[model samples]
Target: MARRGVWELEKITLYYCLQGGSSQGTRGFVEERLASFAKENPQIQFETVIEEGHPEAVGLYRNGYKRTLSLRNLEPIEVHDHLLYLRNTWGEPEQKHSKISYGVISNTPSVQGYWRTEPDLEAPSSVRRSYLGQIPPNVPPQFRSFAQLQRELGLAGVTELLQNLGCSKWVVSGMTGVKVKSRKKRD
Candidate 1:
């Protein structure tokens, strides 16, 4: 099978913008920092842009996502760090996510013994249940759980059943009824 991937440019493009009317020193400072960084890593491509009113350093990734950070009044050290940060990124903003210590490795081999097709240890009879302990033991062969009733009733069946019972009262619950709870009475 062919590998699925994005059409990314082999070289990174550091696209920056400084206001045309700004001090010449600002442009000089930015260019100096960029030049130093470019010299440090020769693989990156620098594309400088001077938009008259816009003033920010933008990291234009091969993937087309641009990260723009203001460098208007910042010192050279800060700008240098920002440039380093932008250059090191995968072209996306810091995503909102939790720090996960363990991850699922789908391709891990079973020889490691961590990956298994079946249960490694048999759970105690008291701890384990057949059919998730859902099916009633006394249920006859032909009978099934109230699966259809749950579908027809929907949630606790309060709203729909209330309508069926000719009760005009409105029941306030969330949009999805799978997380059904009894209506709490107000004081």
Candidate 2:
């Protein structure tokens, strides 16, 4: 038979890490998030199986029969740490929302050592620039155009720019532009 999309219910297992290293708290949080997501998106069903230890958690993902969803922070797993592993039995092994792992490491042992040295990080420069650049100086009194409005108000930051432009929120609503409820008074 041909395969279908990820929404098609087969069986899926999810593994999530609990904060601080407590299995009970981690399991509770995982169950809560899973239940909430499942309830919100009724089409997706999730079943969870908790492993005994961190190694067992890893092993469950590595060799378990069912497809799994593992949720973990980018932080490194330290010695004598406990992690939560969630497993599902009905779906494909890899899904579109599957969690992937990345790492940060240093030769020095102390946490302070990593912060002292500069590393090539992919920081969001565009967002910073957009927030910091001065607003232009030719905006109309009514604030009709983006360029004129952004420039005339002398907006020092995104908050002021958005406030002056009558944008109430920052969400992408359509292809053309964000759908912001106008704050301007209706005359």
Best by TM-score: 1
Residues 3-78 of candidate 1: C-alpha lDDT, one tens digit per residue = 1453222243333345454324346655676667778766566666655553566666666787777666555677
Give the per-residue lDDT of model 2 (tens digit) for 1-187: 1135333342334344343354444455454454554455454444555554431233222233443223333222321122222222333354444246334445668755434355533225674255434444553334335434434543345346677677776542222323457665779
Please list the C-alpha lDDT of all candidates, in the order they appear.
0.52, 0.40
Question: Which parts of model 1 are misplaced by more than 4 Å?
Answer: 1-26, 98-187
Positional deviation of residue 174's Cα in model 2 after best superposition, in angstroms = 76
User: TM-score of each candidate?
Assistant: 0.39, 0.24
How far in Å is the alpha carbon of 143 misplaced in model 1? 40
> Model 2 off-target regions past 4 Å?
1-6, 15-28, 55-69, 73-187
